[model samples]
Target: MLDNIEADFPEYAPRRPGAPKALDGIRVVDFSHFIAGPFATMILADMGAEVIKIEAPGPGDDLRRYPPVHPDLKHGAPFVWTNRNKRSVALDLKMPEGVAVARDLIATADVVVENFSTGVMERFGLDYEACRKIRPDIIYCSVSAYGREGAFADRLGFDPIAQVESGFVSMNGYADREGVRALSPVMDISTAMMACNAILGALVARERSGLGQAIEVSLFDSAVLMTGYATMQHLFSGANPQRHGNTSPDTCPSGVFRAQDCTFYINCGNDKIFQRLMAQVIDRADLAEAEIYATGPDRIRRRDELFAILGEAFARQPWSYWQARMRVAGVPCGQVRTVGEAIRSPEARERGIVTRIPHEKLGWIPNVTLPIRYSGTPIVDPVAAPAVGQHTESVLRELLGYDDSRLGRLASAGVFGADAARRPRQDAKV
Candidate 1:
């Protein structure tokens, strides 16, 4: 059945034709461990950057042990999602030799990204200053929970914590209920996007000035920035926005409404769209003409009644019916898809958003393709995330030109371990 389509449809044939890609030859030395920093580097990697991920010797990144580990995978899904399309090298940066090797890698890299807590890199003597000394044209990006010199610099933070501290949590969920914190890693991913933007901007600047600069992005700052429009409303208009539960505070009919079997979101932001939606999609011309529902503010003032009317109308039909009607009416609407549904959706599959790459241990794993699509250059298939110390010997010998004796000495001293495959074949080489 599948062969029939490939044989008949030339456009949809399984021909390995090369297409246009964007990014070509950039190199990134990723020193980041967790989601935010690594995510940024992953985007760059997808844009065709040669991203080398440097991890510590022991246990590797903590994310490797995170939950939802596929039965055949050593690391969890989150780790795989954040760390595809990169090379891994384990180093004991606390040692002088290890730090030296890292410095050499930086010397050959175009960008350096790290999200360590404030002063960790400085303590290790691998901060921006040190890297810049080796490569004056390096784009150094420091991502943290807070800025390095800020009052909250030393305090640890994650996505939810930043959401609370940055006022995002206060504006979410129900009006009558307490503010509900988002379980999604919005702050982490948003901060990653911001960091990526800064790094790309710095790269552009470096092209002009023939020099590099250090850039900083923090989750706290990004979370606050995401709340800009809402914050300004509070400041300029003296309106304390309350949790309205799935609805936009400034726009009416901009929230989830239920149907017979599913829920969908409809965003009627402008009066014209609202009128069109009412007349075409709902066939409610009288409701559109009512003075209480005519203007934007009037709709907000009578939001409860409007919601009741809309909700009842929507409840009368199945979600698919409303979706088709709304599509024809040019109203912005979408069904709320679960993670599995969205990933396996026809549109997602057609766009190649979900791709399969083979792993040594796991036969094939699904990796979400990077969203950026280029016309001239595209991301190549990346090496799977390494097992602990997977390339220890190869990295040391190739990067530093270490001999067998030097590599043996390092293994004996516990500075670095040999490859996993060689461990059972021989004792410590040193």
Candidate 2:
């Protein structure tokens, strides 16, 4: 078992103090909640941005109380996963004092990220214009389900809705059934990536312009972008793609098939690869020379026949056998592992994708490291996700120079209430 990084890698400063990370020293005020917005900001935080997440005064982010709450963290697993490396400050933005404090924070921030419905920020007086007034070089990132303008601007949209509206759902699954939404939040994750990309681009542009810009990203746009080849086919050939289950219309023998012990996917994308796969894995040199399967189109045309032959061959051996043989032949192949399997697999462990970190309360809890790698400045080892307003007093003192009396006054005024109180030291209970 791997020990906590802080203990094991004592000399590792992950990123050197003077050395700049990809977004080192950048300040971000994150107002987004739930997955998409938080996910994007999480990436920024991992890259060394100082992200301060403002949450509601009471329960804070909804995910805090979401089900599967960890006994030690008292928050959902998903929430902890997305919010590490961020400072949590609970505030009732509805209050005048809270709003004033927020303005002060924004005044010193390089970016403001929010995903409230189209004009909610404007109504709250935290819109781009307001931020620009305080800090001329502020990057205001507004994430929405649809967009800032147009008919659906105010309409509610989620990952599934984006998939349906953008024609992405139509390209999934088999034709026998109505195309289904992906089990995972594909659109949300993609939108997060796009939003991060946009922020990075704006940061680069700002370096030269000495000004800031308002950035917009929508779930619909990300969904449409994800339909790369599907959109291309429709645009160039006037063809509507059908849902082909576990097989590709463009490439035959490129999907899952059953082995004696398990199932696996094999991609014989082109004729040359198919020939190699046949000769190497199937031990069928004669099959490669067969006229009917000489080219991609020909193999695609005879997909059923080809599938029948390949299927029988694959079923003769177990998944591990084929996985090794196919990989050795330089073909792209892998076993269809479950989520649990994938997480614990040797490849994932070796890459340090999943790691154990010592949480204040949990002692040892698992965290997934940021996937991006930079030679000069890698992500800093994450601090444990905070309890509600865990850094309230410290942040107030350090950032705004608030003394004990001022903090007490604010607390008494309900700016910071019961939930903001320091948690009593406790043993691991999760």
Q: List clash counts for every candidate, in order.
A: 6, 0
Best by TM-score: 2
Q: Write the per-residue lDDT of candidate 1 for residues 254-364, one digit (tens) a residue.
A: 888999999889899899889888899999998877778878888888888888989999999998899889889889998899986886677787887766555565555
Give the number of the best model, judged by lDDT.
2
Cα distance off (Å), candidate 2, residue 200:
0.9
TM-score of each: 0.89, 0.93
Which pairs of residues have clashing backbones in candidate 2? none
Error of 2 at 334 (Å): 0.7
Displacement of residue 351 (Cα, Å) in model 2 is: 1.2
Query: How far is 183's C-alpha from truth in model 1 (Å)?
Result: 1.4
Candidate 2's residue-wise lDDT over 350-374, tens digit each?
7777766666655666778877878
Candidate 1 segments whose C-alpha is farther than 4 A from its true place: 1-23, 397-400, 418-430
